[model samples]
Structure formats: C-alpha cells, structure tokens
Target: MSPRRILFIQTQGENAGAQEISRLVGAGLGARGYDVSHLFFYRKSPSFDAPPNTRYCSHDRPRGVLGALKFPMQLLREIRAIRPDAILTFQHYGNTVGGIAARLASSAPVIANQVSARMLMNPLVRTVDLALGMFGVFDLITVNSSDMLMDYARYPNNYSKRLRYIPHGFDLKTTDLTKQQARAAFGLPPDVPLLGSVARLNAGKRLDAAIGTLADSPDWHLVLAGQGPHEAALRQLVVEKHLETRVYFTGELPPERIGDFLAALDVFVFPSRAETFGLAAVEAASAGVPVVASDLPVLREVLASDGQPAALFVDAADRCQFTDAISRVLNDASLRADLIAAGRGLHARYSVARMVDEYEQLLRDLLAPVPQLAPQS
Candidate 1:
C-alpha cells in the first residue's frame, strides 16, 4: 500500500499552458498521496510550486541529435533512483524523452498527452508527424479532447492503439465578488464591456482576429492575456487596425490570478484558429462569463458542447461573423444571462478533481498488475 511514484516531464520550465498542466499534474497527484517527480530539459528552476516529492533531472537538449545528451544519462540515473511506477509526459518532445527513458529504464507505463493539433504547430509539424510516426516508444497516448483525435484523420497512426482520452481539468474554485470588485482587483473598468482572451500570441492561435473584430466598435475593450513569439506581429496588427486605445496586451499572468481576470471580463472571447480542447475557454465558461469563439470543430466539442451549448461560434476566419457574435453577447442582456447560466452548467463538467479522479482510476487500472509502488520519498 505504498504511494505510486509518477515522473512528470517538461522541457522549458516556463509558465505556459503545458507547463501549467505538468505542474498541476505533479502537485495534484502528490496531493492524492502519490510520489511525484518533475524533470525539465534546460533544468532551470521553475517559478511555480513543485510537488513535495518532485526532483529535477536538470537535463539539456543537444544541438544536432534528436535526443538530449544529458537527459538520457540523468534520466537513467533518476529512474534508477526513483523507480517510478509510471512516467507522464506533457508534450511531444517531453513524450519522446520520457517515453524513451521509460523504455530504457524498464516496463514503467509511459503516458503521453498531446495538447495541440499536430499540423498547426507551425512548420515544425511535419517533423513532429514524422517523429510520431515512430510511436513504438510510447505506451498510452492520452489526448485532451476527442476533437483533437479526430483531427489526426490524415495520420491515423499518430496515436496507434495506445490512445486514451483523459481531458485536462482546471481547479474549479472562484470568488463570489461583485463585478466592480472583480474588475478593480483584476485592473479593469466596470463601465466598459471587457472581452478577455487568454492564449499564447502564436500564429495558429489567430489572436489578431479578436482585434480585427473590434475595428468598428470603439467602446468595447479587448484584453488579450498571455505572450508568445507573435507578440510583435499582434502588436503591429493592433496598430495597423488602429486599435491602440481599445485593446491592451497584458503579458502572461500567473495561473492563480485567472479567477480575478475572469471576474473582470463581461464576455470571454476565444478567436484561436486552432486548439485541441481550448482549456482557457473552459476556464472562462467556468467563471460564468458569456463565451464567444470560433466554429472550430475541436473548440466546439469542448466549449460549445452538445448537451448544453455555452459558446456562440462564428466562422474562425470571418471577422464579420466573429464581430457579430461578440456584438450579440454585448447587446443583449437576457442573452448574456442565459449564456452565463448555460456556461456555468457546461463548465461544471470540467474540473481538476473530476479529471484527477478519472486519471487516477486509469493509473490504478494500468498499474494494477505491476509490483507494489514505493512509499513517498
């Protein structure tokens, strides 16, 4: 009856969505009495809290060769040291490393999660597709959404037979603060209707669409939270569309303060052209904010759900439609109320506790036949 050890791997120790999920998985599993260990590529110390049992491998990626020279050695040493019951990886590169390490270390179940669409990760996608073509290293490939799985129709073997659906869930806890209070705390005005979007400023995310949607309406304030490679391009688009006064780019905020941000926004807009599950949009809906987003099938599967539709989806590329969707949420108060209620209802389905329960069950089932897990270190 000792606690099972799970090694969670990541590359850059940044506070991106993937990193956040890794941190949450480690911390959450630890909270559930599992011995969790963390491994990073560059080995820089993380800003967020790591689990009690977390250990850093401190490996670095190599210049030319696909494998990290240091990680193999360090990971081998760590695996021998911890002898984890399983290894969980957050992204492609992490999966490659963790999966390979698990195979090298021995028959520890290696679980890999795919967070985004393969083709949409810029030009490097083909490289990933080719890498995924060799999935002999992976054990269980857990995806955040079925919509994400459906997208790999062209490359059916990207998942092979080890695919499993284990959606990433957010901590579902929010404050019962008034709109004015929430806005003031999150640094927003109570008067102007705020349309908030939280996503990396990447090409595939299509954040510029949010700015484009506001070309005609000068009254609505658009706040895009998070930073990425496309920051300069998005800023240039803001200038090009003459949205300097209406839109503000708040660089990536910490994960803890999201509730404050969600509370401040009257409407939550996700204009991303591509997403596997759109976890941020789910967070917004969980906050009970009216949600408007693209008609991307994956996003629709996650946010604009079938049982209870929470999102007003417009054509991803059509700014007119996107604008109309935003305007509809802003103009109609009754509609806003209905959307908020429906969003809350829909958001109820996605929570960290539920996700943890499901994932823990999966782990238990998979590890049922394995030897006894070690005690928490």
Candidate 2:
C-alpha cells in the first residue's frame, strides 16, 4: 500500500509558532510513513531555511493586489499536483483561500487550524469565517486553546460543531550550553541579571512594559530576541531610558539558537497584550527557565500543570506588577527553584509526540472508510 500524503498550507514559511508546529507535526507524520509536504503562499524567510518537500505559491515577498487576484489559480494548481489524502491549513489566508482551493481541486478532507483569536475580533473576517463554516468549506476547525474553542462555539448557528481543541506541542530538548556559554554567544555580560523575551517586537506584545521593568531594575539587563516593525521604536525606548548598554537586540534567532537564548536568561518575560496560545512561555518553562508572564486566561491554561501555575502571572501593563514578579523570582531562592521545577513538568504536559498522536488519530478518523448498507430486499 502507498503511504498517505498530507499537505500543510500556510500563509508564509516564517519562523513563527504556527510554522514551527507544522514543521514538527509534518516531520512526525513522515517518520510514521506518511508522505508529508508543505505549500506556503509567500516566499520563505531568509533567516529560516525551507525544509525538504516544501512548495511556494509565490517565490518572493507577498505581492500586493495583483498577487491576491492570482492566488486562487496558483493555489489550485499546487493542490492538484500534490493530491494529498488530507489538507491542513494555518493562518487567515490559508484557512480561507487554501480551504477554498483544496475543496475545488481535490476530494481531501480540509482541516482549518486557527491559532489566533485576532480574526474573530474583526467583524468582517469573523462573518466570512462563520459563513464558510456554515457552507462546509472546511471539514474540521482546530484551535490551540480551550478558551478559543469556547469562543468559536458561541458563534450563532451551528458553526461550533466543527471546532476541536488541540494545544500546541514542543520537543523540550535540554540545552547543552551553560548560562555563561550562552551569554558568551550573544556577547552579553556574564554577571548581570538577565531578563529575556523571544517574541516579535510588536505593540500588541506590550514589550514597552518590559522596557519599563528594565528602568526600575537597575541591575538587570534585557534581551529582545526577535525582530518586527516595532524594533526601531523599541530601540528608541531603550535609548530614552538610557538602557542601550543593558538592552540587547539579537534580531531573529534561528530555531537552533532558541534553546541557547533561553539558557542565558534568569527569567523569561512574556508581556503580550494578547495571545491565543502562550507558546514562548511554555517553551521557556520547558528550558527550566522561570517565567514572568501576562495574567491572561489562555496563558493560565497552557502554563499550568497538575493545577499548579508554572509562571509568575502579573498585569503586564502595570510596571510595578511586572517588575515585582521578576524581582520575586530572582530574589527568592526557593521560589525560583519551585518555578523551574514546575516548568520542567510542562515537558510532559505538552509533548510533541502526544500532539502528533492526536493529530494522526484525527486524520485516521477522517479517512476511515464508511460502512456500506445492505441492499433493500
């Protein structure tokens, strides 16, 4: 028998959370004898090398109006060529455009993966998504957070029936580098207390509040490990507060260096204003680095194990609360040990193997042959 072919469709092949999930899951399925492939709408990020079996609808940065008009035909062509047994999609463009293309080009079951609640906040986008759900454009819709699953279930009509909850998973590999070695890689001071965040430098991330925490803690240095549109503004904030020397910007670290970045940090700070799944925080915990994060419900869901919270939760907007949480984790020896222990526990809670198992079962159920009924007498 031939191996089942599964294709993942996403907006771009970037080093983001959704892309990472697809990479891990795709690799897992391939190991299990499935022929896994990826179809990205835009060109791959320069910092992120495209994995094998990857295809792109556009070979450059997202084209403007002309690209949007041409995307359907391009996507349809790719779908026809792949001829996957089932299709899984990520991001808004993939969920809508990819779903439509797969429906038209193949008879595969289409699964739309929603990793963010931001789309639901937009009335027009939400309306369109619900309409597509009503029309059965997607066979299933998966969410990474239970809270998001509930939110989608509340939509008027029966759109809720298609929703499934599957939390994001991680490999949780142990870092070989020690604190001093990791710091040396980034040219950071070996002795200074360090706070780090591995996230896009965006306004919604509320990274400015992280800068504010730095101002209050004179002894601590901050490292912003990712890049985005807000980088220039954040650099200015570091200068305005005279923290140019204390704040380090490493741009975007490739996947291999993420563990090293986490190893060098005393406390991992995630002050995002919103997140559907607090992937970075969970990752920090997996590295056994204590975490200080926003007190969001979704964070509460993903950052807990056996009813114990793995992070120091705070109002990320409040400089005092944010700084205080970091201070407590640093100053109290027992608390730091406890948080680290709790964090290590997350390795099992969000194991990549477990996530892959659930996904495989879902595909099997979707592809199972329906029983034929007896002929009428």
Candidate 3:
C-alpha cells in the first residue's frame, strides 16, 4: 500500500510548544514511511523548522469579530487544493479554523489537539469550541493530559468516545555540553546559583512571580529565555521590583539551543498560572535539572509523586512559597540529586519514540476498514 498523506497545521510558524509538537509528530510520521506536509496560518518569523514539505498560506488576520469569522474560509480554499489522506491541527486556531476547513474540504479524518488546560476560560473561545464540536468539525480530540480531558468532559456531548489522551513526549537527545561549558558560553559566572525558565513572556505564564522570587534571594540569578507581547510589562515589573540586576532576559532562543540553556541552570522554575502538559519542566528534568513549579493539576499529574516527586510544587501566586522551594533545592545537595533521579524516571516514561509509535498506530487504525457484522448476529 502507498504511504498515507498527512498534513499538519499550526496557527503560527514559531518555536512555541505547539509548533514543536507539530514538527516532531510530522517528522515521526515521515520516518514511518508516511508522506507529511506542514501548514502555518501565519509566518511572522522564520523560527519554526519546516521539515521537507511545508507550506505557508500567509493568511491576513484582519481585526476583531469579522476577521475571526473570515479566517476559516481562507483556510477552506487552501485545504481544498492540497487534499491529503488526513489532517492534524495543533492548538486553538488550528483546531477551530483548520479543523473546520478540513471538514469542508474533504471526508478525511480531522484530528484536533488541545494544548491548553485553561483555553476555555475565555467565553468567546469556549463558545466557538463547543459550536465546532456540535458541528462535528473534529473527528478526534487529542489532549496531552487526562486533567485537560476532564476539563472538556463537562460539556453535554459524549466526549469520552472522541477524546484521546496522549502525553507530550520529549526527544531524549542532548547537546554535547556540560553545565560549566553552557554557562561559560553565556558569560555567566561559575559560582552564582542560576534559576532559569524557558517560556513566552506572557501573563498566563506569570513570569512576574519568578522575578518576584528573585527579590527574596539576592544570591541567586534568574534567567528567562523566550519572547512575547508581555516583554515590556515584565521589564517594567522588574524595574518596579528593583530586580534589574538579578533578572536577565535572553529573548527567544532557537529550539536547538534550548538544551544548552537548560544545562546552564542550577534549578528550573515554572510558575505558570495554568499548564496543559508542562513541556519545559519535563525538558528541564530530562536535562537533569531540579524543577520547582506551580501546583497546578497538570503539573501535579506530570511531575509530583507520593514517593519522590520529579519537581517541587508551590502555589502559583505565592512568591514566598516559590522562594522557599528554590532555597531548599539550592541548599541541599541530597535533595538536588533526588530530584534529578526522579526526573530521569519521568523522562523514561515520556519518550518521543513511544509517542511516535502511539500516534502512528492511531492513524493506521483510523484509516483501517471497518469490520462487517455476521448475518446471524
């Protein structure tokens, strides 16, 4: 049989979490002898890695409600032309616009990914998602965590049948760099304790809480690697809190260099108000760095344990609690070692190979011919 043609759609062509998933999944499918192509709704920056076959429609995003309504039609034309065996969309815009496009374009199965636990917090988004679900725009909804699936189960539909739980897995490969080498590359001093996070400087991430924790401990330095619209606000917060010297922003590092950044950190901090999978935390753990993160349900599901937790959990808004957790991890050598070991355990469970295998098998099953019932039955 010929290889199935799969199209992966993403809202943006950036190195954000969703885009990374799209790239990895597409690459995985391609390696499995499937034909893969990538589509991006917007291509503001050339940050995303467009493996072999990629297309950028450059759809103009108009302003406000009218623009939002018009977006799906734009996708409808493109999807109609490049009709593939199936379509997989990542994140909200892809799930909503690209999903509807896929349904209108062809009878191919449309797989929608839900990456945020709190995406429905917005009234408009919630209404849109529910409407799409009722219209059968999505054939299957893939969530990175069970906690996120539960969040969606509150609606009226029999979502249990359509929803699939697939954990976000990491590429276990590492860059050939030691902690000392990574820190030296960035001109960071050898002895200063470093606390780092790789996240977009957005309000939902609550990077201010991480900066606020810096005030509690002058001995440690905070390094943030990522860029977004909230950079100015976060910079002003750093100025207001007098954390200019202690806090450093590295803009957005390329995906390839993220491992180096993780290696340079003495401890990794994830203080997001909400998270669906906590990918960065898992990546930090994979790099053998101790993590202290917000006590969100998704974080607890991925990292915390009754036996030995992979990360130290703290209240999202409590800077004091974050500071306390960081202090304990930094002060105790034994605790650091234990956290690293726990992190390795998590890395083993969430391997990229396993994720790829599951995705491939699911796609095959979806494409398989349905069994016929016996005449007697």
Candidate 4:
C-alpha cells in the first residue's frame, strides 16, 4: 500500500502552543511511514530540511490590498502543486486558508484542528466566518477540548456541523527528572518550595493574580516564565505589590528547559483566563507535580471532568482563590500527594503516541469506503 500524502498548514512563524502541537503530531506521522508535509504561512524558501517525504511550502504575502488579493490565488496554486491526499491545518487563520484552498484545489478531505479556544470565543469576522463555514464542508474538524468544539458549534444557524475533541499531544513517557536533580541542574536551593507558571506573557494569562497570592509568603518562591505584551504590566505589579523577592521573572525558557523547569517546581499554577488545553499543567501532571488551575469550562474539561479534581481549582482572575489554592496545595503534603497521583493517572491518557494514533485512525476512518464525519448528524 502506498503511503498517503498529508499536508499540515500553519499561517504563522511564531512558536505558540498550537504550532508545537502540530509539529509533534506531524513529526509522529512522518516517523510512522506517512508522507507528512508542513506548509508555512511565511516561509520564503525551503531553507531547512524536513523528514523524508516532508517539506514546507512558502505561502508568504505582504500585508495590503495586493497581498490580500494574491493570498487566495497563491494558496490555490500551492494546494494544486502539493496535491496532498489529505490536508490538516492549525490555528484559526490557517484553518480558514486551508479550508478554502483545499476546496479550490480538489475534493480531497481537509482537517481543521482548533488548538486555540481564545480565537474560537470571539465573534469571527465575516471573512473568517465564511472560511469556518467552509470548515463544515471539510471531512473533519478537530478541537483540543469539548469546550472548543462547543465554541465552534455555538452558532449552529451560521455554522454547519459538530467537531471532534482531540486533546493536545504530549509524551507521558518522558524521562521523569527528580526534584533534586532538576534543582541541581537549574542551580536552585533544594529546600525552598518553588511555584511556577508557564504561559504567554499576555493580559489574559492573569499571572498577576498568582503574584498577588504569593506576595506574603516569602518562603513560597514563584517563577513566571514566557514573554509577551503584558510583561511590563506584570513587572510593575510585582514591584508595586512588594513581591520582588517572593516572585522571580525568568522570562521565557526555551523548549528544552520545559521538563527541567516543571521538574524543579513543587507545584504548578495556571491562572489563565482561557486555556483550551493547558499543556503546561498536563506536563506538570506527567512530571508528578501537583497543579492549581483556574475553575473554567475548559480547565474542568481538561482536569476535573475525568473525576480528578484533586488538583486544586480556583478562579483564574481571583487572587484570593489563587492564593488559597496554591497555599492548600503547597502547605498540605497529603493533598498534594493525592493530587499528583490522580494527575499522573489522568496524564497517561494524553500521550503524544496516543494522540498520533488517534489521528491516524481518524485519517484512515475518513478514507474508508464511507468516511465518518465528526460523529454528528
């Protein structure tokens, strides 16, 4: 049997959580004897190498009327040349483009993977809305959580069909580094209780609440990683709140240090206002660290819905609740231990291998004699 050609598309150069998920899934597929190709929104030329039968297509367009007009034409042309058997796209912008381009190129199936619930909540522009409507015409729609799928289905009158929830991929079998080893590697004190939060430095992340919660507890050291537009505001808050000692700003650590950082932390706090699937929290869980996250729809879907609310839950924007949750998780060793155990069990289901296998099954199922669509009427 010949390997099927799959095209994965993303319309950005920045490395966000969604892009990382796509890369992991794509890499997994490529390794498993599938012809997986990734298309970039801004690649000027094939500058780097990809896996066998995998390559990037340049889909750059300058920002203007000319660029806007030329984008669709260029996308159509690229799709025709690639001639992929199936198409997969990440992020809302890429999904819109891929949906339209795939239809124009051929009747082959397309997969629009929604990794961002933030984008799904807002009222999409008419153009993007039309593009999403095109998504209904595709073979399948994938979301990281049921909340995200519901977001897509919110406007049923305007929208077309149901979407499937395919959680973000992770390697649960990753090497588990000991707290002592991780601390030594990062050169941290062995005894101090460390609290960590990893996410984009944006207003919606609500890390200020975490700082406020930890301000009085000098012994409860906190580390805020990831850079974004809200850095100045967060830094100002740290000084204003007199939490300069309790809270440390490490900026954004590279991808390599993710496991190390998670390992060093005694507990993980995610105070984001919105998270389709908290990959950081999941990683912390896989590392056997207790997590404290916001009590939101998606957070519950990711953590609580599975009957494992042992991980402390608090309002994302509530400093009081955030502080209470963190304190409860940190001060009470028994509670933390239970939470970590439950988290590990829950994390087992989210491994990257399982994620890739699900996608492979979905693709194969979609290519079956009568392709099943989203399991909806």
- Score residue 130 of candidate 1 by CA lDDT: 42
lDDT of each: 0.74, 0.86, 0.80, 0.72
lDDT of 2 by residue, 1-377 (tens): 57899999998777777888899889999999999999999765678656679999888755689887787788899999999999999977778778888889999999889876764345766666777788898888889888888777787556778888888898674579999999999999999999999987778788999889977779999998887779899999889999998999988877888999899999999998888897888999878999999998889988988888899899989889899999999999999888888888888888789889988988998996646688899
Reference-based lDDT, residue 22, model 1: 72
- How far out, in Å, is residue 29 in model 4? 2.3
Instruction: State every prediction's TM-score relative to the real structure.
Output: 0.85, 0.93, 0.91, 0.81
Q: What is residue 233's positional error in candidate 2, in angstroms?
A: 2.6
Q: Flag regions of model 1 displaced more than 4 Å.
A: 43-81, 105-107, 122-135, 152-159, 304-306, 368-377
Q: Write down the RMSD of all candidates, one decimal each.
A: 4.2, 3.4, 4.3, 6.0
- lDDT by residue (1-377, candidate 4, tens digit) is 56777888776544357656877888898889877877766643232223234333434545788877776677677778878888887777777766777777866788777766645344564357445655465567787887877776765543536366777777553446787897777666778889887887887778887777766676887887777678899899988988776677766665567777788888888888787788777767766878998888777777752576646778757666677778888889889878877777765667788889889888887775534467666
- Candidate with the larger TM-score of 1 and 3: 3
Candidate 3 steric clashes: 0
CA lDDT for candidate 3: 0.80
Query: lDDT at 287 for candidate 4?
Result: 69
Top-lDDT structure, candidate number: 2
In model 2, the Cα lDDT at residue 266 comes to: 94
Q: Give a tens-digit lDDT track for model 1, residues 1-377.
A: 67888888765555567877777667777888998877766543334444355556663334455454655787778777888788777766676656677678867877777776776754564465345535656666778887765655445565556677777777653767777897777667679978888887788878877888787787888888887789999899888888888788767777776777788887888877778888788878877888998888877677754466778888858878888889999899888887777778654577677777777877887787646668888
How should the candidates be ordered by TM-score, best one leading?
Answer: 2, 3, 1, 4
Better of 1 and 2 by TM-score: 2
| Highest-TM-score candidate | 2
